[model samples]
Target: MKRVASTLHQGALLGLLCIPVAQAATGDAGSDAGTQASPTLKAVTVTATRREESLQKVPVAVTVLDGETLERDNRNNVSSIVQEIPTLNYRPSASNKDSSLFVRGIGTISTSPGVEPSVATVVDGVVYARPGQSTLDLLDVDRIEVLRGPQGTLFGKNASAGVLNIVTRDIPEQTHGYVDYAHYGGGDENRLRFGIGGRLSDTLKGSLTTSVGRYDGNVENVTNGHEVNGYERKGVRGKLEFQPRDDLKLTLIGDYSDGENDTPSVVVKPSAAVAAGISPVVPGNSNRKISSDYKTYVDDRNQGLSLQADWSLANDFTLTSITAWRGWNNSQYQDNDNLAALPVTAVHDKGTVDYDQLSQEVRLTSPKGQFVEYVLGTYLFHGKSDETYRRLSVTNSVGNTGVADYSATNDSYAVFGESTFNFRSDLRGIFGLRYTLDQIEYDHRRVSTSAVEVNSIRPSYASSGSHTDSGISGRVGLQYDLSDNLTSYITYSRGYKGPAYNVYFNMQATDVQPLDPETSNTWEVGLKSSAWSNRLTANLALFHSKYENYQANFYDVVGTSVVTRLINAGSVTSQGVELDYALQATRQLKLSGSLAYTQARIDQFACPSGAAASCDINGKPLPFTPDWKSFVRADYDIPLDNGLDVELGTDYSWQSKVQYSLDQNPNSEEGAYGIWNASVGLADYSKGWRVALVGKNLADKAYAPVLSTGTSTTRIVPRDDRRYFGVQLHKDF
Candidate 1:
């Protein structure tokens, strides 16, 4: 029955991807409205506010990536693409479709399948509930915005840390479309995609996009007796626009994706060996499966629909509405170990989540000429999330105990606002606030196979908790125009993270205790400059953050389950400095590089059991955080005749050591490593067509992005370390 459901879901996902993009409506009038406009080194962005503004004029710290950059890097997946961005990291896991993300050394690490991500991802206007589902294939991307500070006022829930806003191209007012195809050698891979957009009438426009990709697993699965860790992905999306009047605009967007693949089930190597009656290999070096009886497999399906509307009732008053619905199902089974050299056991885990969200916002702003240039808004957001999970343990030495199940239903809402006043043009200040309410309920049960009856080890717990935390998270920024090409600024701000249901629920079921809410206050100062004929640009920032009521999670001594808890953790401090520089050495050559250095630690934290005088990580660096990281890229365009173009570009990223576990396992620490990526392309922008040869991770470096804690070191999710040569072709018609 389970297999049948998975098969059906996979088929539906594939069917969506197979739709032809050209069949979609394409009669829009504004599709080419700005194509002939003068281009600049920076683009205008609107996610920070409800209105469009130039990036340089925005007072926030942000990272922007345009469509050209995404295609040049050949990063179709969000998880894979974020690795190139500084201060962002993803931890790979087989049981979940989405990886975990850490920003500025803070994030959640859990396989519970029901917890909300600390970082939030917004596509179009909808806020995705889970990271895995939020990372589906991106189609018709216009721009991506990464806001680095706390966005409590604008983004609300899960914006405790930061926000990632993704905007897709609105259906062009004019007729236009593109078809792209790529072939990758060494991985038996191929990818094809096409999209079209245009106005159906003066009041309506629409677009359709679809893509499919196939690739072989890089790992050789000796246990399965064939390759078992590669995958295939297919996805499709549709969008429509309706403008009934000059003051009202509405958009509807829908997307779906399905994937089928084989993956190695991860397990504790030493435990697997003991269960299989095999000798244990040295920690970290040993490759052993926890289960050998069954092979690991994965089936993932995702779908979402969103509605957005903008209504400008008056010259300075506007209202916005965003409604979202998303569903996801992820299933997996594995031998639980990367190596089959020794006897092993296998485990099976499956889960599903369905989510719905509704958000409404109304803003009142002053006309441009007013000295009181301000933005005042009130927002209400509500989301309902449901999740179900099941786990089964099977091994040669241990028999299956049927399956254990856990389910949760979460409902949450928030109201927030922000406003700015230009005391003077050069000295502007802002203030913001947010009020929130969330309720989470859980259902846990165990099934007995012999009698087919369900028994409850724990009674169903339904509790409603409310927290009204109001903080002034705003910035005081002063911009000084030193010259026509140079600008500098110094800014200071405060941020916070609201309490979560996960803390309380985790405490009810685990030995680790839960504590109060976690919060942080940060201060930052920065300088920006552009000089030398707009060919040279440099930015530097120094920041310090103080964390209080820090949250911590650890495993029980038996290591069978994770315990949720918190501590005052005294007060930890993180101070960092960063420098980004870009220089145009010549008209045909450009060099850019960025360097980052951060030191984070726990000033005071008690032991898990509260008995030990000395602990594993009292003053050591936080886990999964690198101390020093840097990136460099160079692009050179060769001079050619007859309108031909030849361009070459390469980038390199490296990081210092990072702790993998709280136990302070030296063997599990990640060492400094680097990968080389390069691309070569042809054709001129004036023709609207180009082709490129690209290679990623050219060195094929072997490393693990994440590891689990246990009595013994085990469960390493290895990074893809294979080289692929691919050809990319894109054309606009």
Candidate 2:
């Protein structure tokens, strides 16, 4: 492989982030490295191992996105950042309720109240129980750490796939704040945000941040005379810090957000029956125009409260505790038929969800540079959710209408610890383990029905069940120092996810069984190097993982209705190679990029005895697991005699073709494509004022992240699916 340099900040995403020319990332080699003659990257901090450490010192494969990168990306939700990540992908739906995440081709695709996500999302040490919670717009984010591979020992939840760890900025010690505003063309987007923080006394401080934003969608809606797939959102976040004693510190954080999203999939490849009545509203299918009888909308609210305390014990060890509560509510209405006017009376489709969770974690950490440094902790969690889904039959003239209401609860307990042994100064060994117990239960009932629904609806029937499971997950690894600034390591880990129940509205007799726990074992080897006096940095890793009883969704036809049921696949495997590189090419320029090659596939379907002929899907690529993916970026800086500086940057991201259907449906495949973005900014650091003009998809490339052929050949349109321009203004006080 050819060796190249890349900055440590991969967060700029397909070019959403900026890797400064004169700056690298992680710890500073020396003050001289920052000189104009030989500029070096500065220190970047992270807590991937449950402790504050330099990014380069961490053993895990991690991607860091700094605060500045997010500001420039101007993409608010979590999905915006996944676009260009090496081996990371997301599952898109019409609403957050069906959103999911994938890593190395492993992810969950079910919305059952009893099914937990494979990829876990953590915000300041608090896990978001549902995948949708992580989709909310971020506020005052300090950084985001995307950890590839399993993180089961320390996190000790359903983090069998990977983890997206988000860290919010801390309260400022001095009285200061910032204001940001942006206006965009094409979609008529306008956004404004304000943040202020200060110290009230020697022992107390607080900060507040508020934001509001709205945009017209890129997709045209002819029936409603309003653009669909648009966004309207408002949110606020607050934080308080108190240090009554030198040994103790307490922090309280609260946040709330409300959003309205108009999302309705459009038929990219219309079926024979649905294409005859359509007329051209937009030029072509790629123009992203749709016609629906009833306006489709998804409204949601999310709020949370957390209290964290850190105490420095007299014995030199640190003790910490975090208590948190979070809640999310969502309601949605969609045009199920997805046609302007069809004989199907499927317009009365709706869904509602109310979910809440409470959790507590207490941990103790030993001081560094000891014979045995370790972190020990205990975790407890409780969650409850209620859902109601009502839909009119697509074949209303020949089908029926009904409502399904269900509720579920999940409880977990675990004890976990990790230790690093310094066998020698240059060589170390790390081992960790976690013991977890999970309990899940659900109650579902079908109450109302019209048109004398068929046997699939199961009206007037109620059922309830519970399940319990336990497992041990852990990791073992070794690190060897080859040189002063280079290290090599190999690790083996076992990860696990809890069992699940299919608790959807259409309660059938065969759907009452609980799924088995999902498990994976992985082996990875990597090299971390920052050579040539800290001007060049490169990290490389190769990993292979085997998963058993992988949870997935399977469609079964019954009486003119396609029911989506949860099941376990026999076996699967994911093996990949990843590279992150950055280099300070010159004092005025920098070059950076990341690349990955992945082969994720199904080894066996574990088909049934008789009709197993259809299960010959062995060797098929997993959904969203592209074989090749890469991102490249360049940045340049110039200084003028007027005490001002200018920054220019550009980036491009591309990936090979991948199937979006688990069943290997050809209509759900998206071919290879790439996107380009550019930005120009002028800044005056002394006065803390800046202005920038940003353009995304400059080539006007058209692509979709998700597609479905079950009902119709439909595609979900995303923001930035087309060319758009925005200008941003910022001021600091």
C-alpha TM-scores of all predictions: 0.83, 0.93
lDDT per residue for candidate 1 within 42-116, as digits (tens), equals: 324656654577555565666666666786687776666555666666666664553666666666665443345
Native-vs-model 1 lDDT? 0.60
lDDT of each candidate versus the true structure? 0.60, 0.82
Top lDDT hit? 2
Q: For residues 494-526, could you state the per-residue lDDT of candidate 2 as single tens digits?
A: 998999998887766677889899999999987
Every model's Cα RMSD, please? 11.4, 4.5
Off by over 4 Å in 1: 1-46, 112-115, 156-158, 265-292, 337-346, 361-369, 394-396, 447-492, 503-515, 558-571, 610-614, 684-687, 709-720
